[model samples]
Target: MEISVFSIQKSKADNFENEIKEYIKMSSKFAKISDLTIFNEKIAKAQSAGSESALKSYDDIYEPNLKGFCIALDEKGEKLDSIQFAKILESNSQISFFIGGAYGLSQNFKQKVDKIISLSPLTMAHKIAKLVLFEQIFRALCINANHPYHK
Candidate 1:
């Protein structure tokens, strides 16, 4: 499987950056990572852009290359266990995840995705959201492989 993360922004904190990098490195063991595209959150929010419009702009940018299953990460989305998410990873050869900006994902984008899931019930900074998503993905891969990392 090939997993791709389309994130709104990169983490500026050094520690968070390092952790994300480590998770990315660890994830290579599970699936082929095609791309980790980070769009500038500031640019995404610029010039009177609402969440809906900004998200649509991104949809245009990444939607074409996207194939197979797609998922959106949002606060209001479903909460899945590692086992369940592992099934999703196993089923799709090309899976793409849409991570929102600081303001979060738009309603239109939420509705357009094949599935929607939430990392946590509490609101988080978008950068942290990216980290959590990456970790969960790694955990899911571990679970699928019967590896010890899931625990």
Candidate 2:
């Protein structure tokens, strides 16, 4: 199975990139995984403008490569523990996870996604969300492989 993460915006912090790399390395010890692909979109000029513009930008970039099951990161989606997430990893053939831009994913993208997963109820920055998702993917791989990292 190939797991792909399509995220908007580039990683700004060096620490965030390093952390994501660490988790990717850990996950690779068990299974085949792809690097997080950033889909760059121009940010809205006005801060007051709702996230709609960014979301639309994400939709435009995201819609084409969306094959297989697309999972959107959402606050209201089903919350899965590490074990359950492992099951999802084990069951699916090709899974693509989307981390929206500053504004979050558009309703159109959300509507097309196969599943919506919430990492946490509290709003997290895009960079942090990528790190968290990477760590969770590593944790899930450990669980599936019966590795000590999970316990």
Candidate 3:
């Protein structure tokens, strides 16, 4: 299976970047992994036009030829614990996650995704949120492998 995460954020702190890379390295053992950081500047320009417009551009790239489930980290989305998350990954051959810009994804974007998930009820910066999401994904991998890293 392949896992890809698409996100919009400014550059991360070095520590955050390093840690995320480490997690991805560890998670790569379980599946093919990739991450795309959609820079804030591009989204800013798109936001000037409107979030929906920016999201449409994203859809143009990722929406078509989708071979697996698509998920978005959304505040109003459903919640799933580590075990359930691992199950989601194991069940799919390809998965993509979208983390929108500061303003959040539009309803149109949310509706298009296969699942919308909430990491927490509280809001967070997109950069930091990416770290948290990566960690959870790593944890899920550990759980799936019956590794002690999850606990």
- Residue range with the least summed lDDT across 10 consecutive positions in model 1: 39-48
**How big is the positional error of residue 139 in model 3, measured in Å on the Cα after superposition?**
0.6
Better of 1 and 2 by TM-score: 2
User: For model 3, what is the alpha-carbon lDDT of residue 19?
Assistant: 82
Expressed as tens digits, the lDDT of each residue in 96-137 for candidate 2 is 899887778778889999999999999887777888998999
The most accurate candidate by TM-score is 2
In TM-score terms, candidate 1 sits at: 0.83
Per-residue lDDT over 6-111 for candidate 1, one digit per residue giving the tens place of the 0 to 100 score: 8756445552777877887888988876436566654456414775566666666556645678898888889988888889998888899987765566676667
Candidate 3 per-residue lDDT, tens place, 49-139, comes to 9767777655554555344799989887898999999998878889999887756777776788889999988887777788899999989
The alpha-carbon lDDT assigned to residue 8 of candidate 2 equals 70
TM-score of each: 0.83, 0.88, 0.86
Q: Rank the candidates by TM-score, best first.
A: 2, 3, 1
For all candidates, the clash counts are 0, 0, 0
CA shift of 99, model 2, Å:
0.3
Q: Point out where model 1 deviates above 4 Å.
A: 10-15, 40-53
